[model samples]
Target: MKRNPRKVRWTKAFRKAAGKEMTIDSTIDFEKRRNVPVRYDRDLVQTTIKAMKRVGEIKARRERAFFKNRMAVSRETQRAHRRKIIEGVKAGVKLHEPMSVESPVSSKVQEKIKVTAKRHTALLPGEGRSMGMDID
Candidate 1:
């Protein structure tokens, strides 16, 4: 069985059609096959190699920029969708009472209180030393 190149997801045609690849870039033009025969010169070959490297770099940069732009748009849409869901949830939910204020004792104060209570209990006569050693 034969498969259409345009329909295959991995094919260049499909990627170009789907706007997932650079279709009309100048670097892309450099990649086309030329049937014309040229006399091989050492200088020409070296220049061609340099040009190819430069073109590859330009193409890669352009592709990265394109991908970043596409992902940015997707990220924005995802953020908007998440915000919409949160808003919907907020609208449907009702609190029975007003939200409570923070405790009179701050977190640091609570932690210090707990530590002091533990120290006091540990120092008590009946209770044995933790880990066979006094923790003072």
Candidate 2:
């Protein structure tokens, strides 16, 4: 392939200014001939462009590092969520309790009036207790 002289000159100029390579796309208009900057010049053709391997390696390394950080954050978030659920269970927060329109003040007062679990209870200790395992 013989590339046009004008296309070759413009491609060289674009690469020199941008510090990157661009291929002359003769199919398109001359003003829009230069494509996006590539890691290696596509004009000279003998074998594969040398810089392509380095560019690919750099991209792969960056992608791996990004996913690694993302996974770490995801794991941390999951652990924190699990810890919160456990703590809520320990505090007697019925995690799976269905929502209903009940008076907040009345419920609080009723909780105080009710006999403590230690003092008196109809059911046997730990007989029907649950961890409220609804994890929606």
TM per model? Answer: 0.66, 0.34
How would you encode candidate 1's per-residue C-alpha lDDT over 1-136 as one tens digit per residue?
8899999999999999999997888898888899998999999999999999999999999999999999999999999999999999999999688667987677775452434333444444546544445555
Model 2 misplacement above 4 A: 1-33, 36-43, 46-48, 93-136
**Candidate 2 local lDDT, 1-136, one digit each (tens):** 7875444656766554543332333322323445676576556532434455555666567657656876798899999999999998889954576777875576545543656566654545444664444345
Top candidate when judged by TM-score against the true structure: 1
lDDT per prediction? Answer: 0.87, 0.58
After superposing all C-alphas onto the true structure, candidate 2 shows an RMSD in angstroms of 21.6
TM-score of predicted model 1? Answer: 0.66
The weakest ten consecutive residues by lDDT in model 1 span 112-121
RMSD of each: 8.6, 21.6
